[model samples]
Target: MKIRISWWWLPYGILMLASNMWKSALFLLLVLSLHESAHMMAAKAFHYEVPQVVLYPFGFGASILHLGHGSLWRETLILLAGPCVHLVVPFLLIVLVKFDLISITYANYLEQLNQSVLLFNLLPIYPLDGGRILLNFLHLFLPYCCGLWVNYALSVSLVLYLFHETAVLSFQIVLLFLLFQQLLSWLFIKREKEQFYYYRYLSAPKRIRLKHPFQDCFRAFYNVIRFEKEWMQEKAWIRRYFEKEDLKKRKQSHQIML
Candidate 1:
């Protein structure tokens, strides 16, 4: 799909940018834009269509389509591609700075951007790489519902864990924005449950949750860890329906070929 990058993202960013001084805002945009662009390019490389790029003050992201390839590994890799650049860019900048190639004027700023993107994006929230990867991997253990809860659970835990870290610039302020976005996203799911089949499908897909070391350790060692029966039931039924649908789709494809 053809992608559109809105010019308004620049003006809207003023609230974030202007506060950190125009320089901080500018650096923020530069770093986030590069990170998001890497995601777009990776999706395209994998032959998926990307149609929208949304830039925010704290970060920027893209709406990628056709990435639901049904394979846990594929989804995890795709989710990971974005953060790969975040890590790489900072290291390169550090190299340049260390070699006396780049001006020291940006030395502190670059360090902050490096740490910020690494710390922020790595937070185990649903849309974040860590959250996405965790949820997908959780699928192997049982139903999609369980996997989703696992994702949600991990996201929450990760956010809570992040509270102990105090080095990042404006950590609380940025986190508040991220937390607000997450709350609104959850609200969106709740309010539009029926309208969004994908949302429903994600948490309701049928699959067997395998016995991984994580699960074994959690249940065997931590009795406090648990799964919701309602989620498991929903996931079982969804998996069955998906299987039936897939068979029907294949049959249709065969008939067409004949």
Candidate 2:
């Protein structure tokens, strides 16, 4: 996958250099890279197409093109992979220390960094791994649209609460950026939902069974629903939806011509 550096990284680097914390910044980047690499490896194992990986000042984020179209179980595993790296790395660091490959002081520093990164990433903010895991779990019970709304709402609330509790100016700025990102997502939620449905329409269907017809289709598996004691395939439902949309478009065009 292609690698990109975020524009914010430049200023962040400068700030770190000015503060004489460049070493810490570099170490954090290394840790973040390892974290993202775990995610990439897991995605590859599932044969998902990873388009690009972006490095932000805070951490690294990967763009997996078909991530949302896959089974929820696989998605959850991919999301957990990054955090699992943090959990495993501390033990690895201990091994290195025992072997005298690294000083205990340096190993301690890395361990602390790992913990900090893991904790920050676990915050229930949209687009974060923790937020996504929460969304995936929610999808098991709630309609896809309802789960999305709940995820966004929780993200906004948490960010607002962070703003009140945080005293660090730089961290506050980061929180503000996250808040802005969530607002943009909230504003374009309808468009996102449409794209989500379109993707589901194009992807291969799975034979998952559900008891009731959800407002939106499957988030984890492509479902066949037993609604009112009749079985309904998700593919057929989506096909009918597209047909209706096409008919509406044709009628609009015909009326405009008249």
Best by lDDT: 2
Candidate 2 similarity to native, TM-score? 0.84
For every model in order, what is the number of clashing pairs?
A: 6, 0
Candidate 2 stretches with Cα past 4 Å from truth are 57-59, 95-103, 211-213, 224-232, 244-258
* Model 1 regions more than 4 Å off: 1-20, 66-69, 91-102, 160-169, 184-258
lDDT of each: 0.59, 0.82
Error of 1 at 135 (Å): 1.3
Candidate 1 residue 12 Cα shift, in angstroms, is 5.7
Q: Candidate 2's residue-wise lDDT over 68-134, tens digit each?
A: 5557898999999999988888888889899998899999988887898799889889888888888
Best by TM-score: 2
How many Å off is the CA of 41 in candidate 2? 0.7
